[model samples]
Target chain A: MTMRSPLSRVRGLGSAHSGTEHFLTQRMTAIANVPLVLFFVYLLVTLAGRSHAAVSATLSNSTTAIFLLAAILSVVIHMRIGMQIIIEDYVHHDGLKMSLMMANTFFSIAIGLCAGFAILKLNFGL
Target chain B: MAEIRTRNPRPLSPHLQVYRLTMTMAMSILHRITGAALYFGTILFVWWLFAAATSRGFEALNSFFDTWFGQLMLFGYSWALIHHMLGGIRHLVWDTGRGLGPAEREFSAWATMVGSISLTVMVWILGLTLRG
Candidate 1:
């Protein structure tokens, strides 16, 4: 039992000063993924053995495009956060860990943008 | 800071060799492995998307994915996705301050393993039948 200011105790801030945000966000994405992934699996099953035009037409549907975009965004964010935690745990070197964390963020963003753009282009028949 | 040079080096506690493996421990490690697998496996998704959007390379990509090796990779990727998904659900249950008991934890671990395989098989079967 150490003495601490009431405000500080009430804040309950961790070293990063943002308590529980990362944990909650991760869970939020997981919850979102449940239905999204189910839909994705169903989509895949429907697309199997179909012609390129047929598959493209299915994905070009507005609803399909929207769901794909949301899933891609959620997945990329979730992946980045998950990888960041792993890197932080395993990488003891400060410099290398920082660099890896940055790379992870950029990689996730790149994947998200590329996938999202592809979906939008298909949806618009571009 | 200088003390680092003179510090004693010791084997860390809870080393894998010394500890008897348990279902929960194995599942925990598998969850991480599968998560990493999915991380790399996502490139396939991007490739498919790019191919679909361009409408030029899709036929070649599709044929490649139909090969024996491609089917094997797809099978592995599907299993990884489902397993990781069930593992995520288990984690979410734990986050709610529930399922921490020994029996519940073990059951969840087994359920994740079994459910993923079952789902993957069922999905593949459906895909195969519908293709006919």
Candidate 2:
């Protein structure tokens, strides 16, 4: 009942087997981002013109911390996947593309960790 | 695998330069550009978080963000974020197997551009007014 080519089936491959997962996760993150990003903008507006202590205090709230962390995680993953697609399409060189893909993943992870750690530290008043 | 070589230069597919510009095409490119911009812009978010966490150098960072140049950069970043966001929504709509008609596609493109700018302006206005 499969539509895949016989050769593809024999090779146990099907058009970049992970494409659907990538596409779905991208969309899922996009949906999650809609509300989370709105909340983020609201946080920014609330923080505007405030003192450092005031800003930190606002971020220290558990709800605020949770939302911020979630947004950061989703945004980073979504960004990495998006960039990977662009790199795949435009970078034809196998070596260069693989390097860039690795860099992109590492960069996203680094950003996520740094941002998440900062949020947690602030939340704990450390 | 046997080594293979082409006697002639490989035929390359037509790229951006080969096509005439259109609104949808431009917006599609801009969506990717703005998405990339947001990737870089996340550094600003991280800086803010780090400043908040350390409770040191926060004022200096705040002052820098308050300056005209910093404000301009923030404005650009906000616009890019908003634009990419609306572009994402447009993409989601397309994913649902809807809005693929040529007219709907063009309308969505225009809406994404205008809506992002308007939303950014509204947020900025609210921020300024609330500060007063």
Candidate 2's displacement at residue A126, Å, is 2.5
Candidate 2 residue lDDT tens string, A7-82? 7655633445778899899999999999998888878776865798789888999999999999998999899999
Computed on C-alphas against the true complex, the DockQ of each candidate is 0.41, 0.49
DockQ of 2: 0.49
lDDT per residue for candidate 2 within B25-67, as digits (tens), equals 9899999999988898898889888988997789988888889
Question: After superposition, which runs of candidate 2 have C-alpha atoms over 4 Å from their true positions?
Answer: A1-16, B1-7
Model 2 error, position B80 (Å) = 1.2
Tens digit per residue, CA lDDT, model 1, B1-132? 011333677665676777888999889999999998888777888889888899878998888878988778887887888899999999988988999999999999899888999999999899878777
Q: Which candidate number has the best TM-score?
A: 2
| Candidate 2 docking class | acceptable
lDDT of 1 at A46: 70
Any residue pairs clashing in model 2, and if so which? none
What's the distance in Å from true for residue A49, model 1? 4.1
Task: Please give the RMSD to the true structure for each candidate, in Å.
Answer: 4.0, 3.8
iRMS value of model 1? Answer: 4.1
Local distance difference test, candidate 2 = 0.88
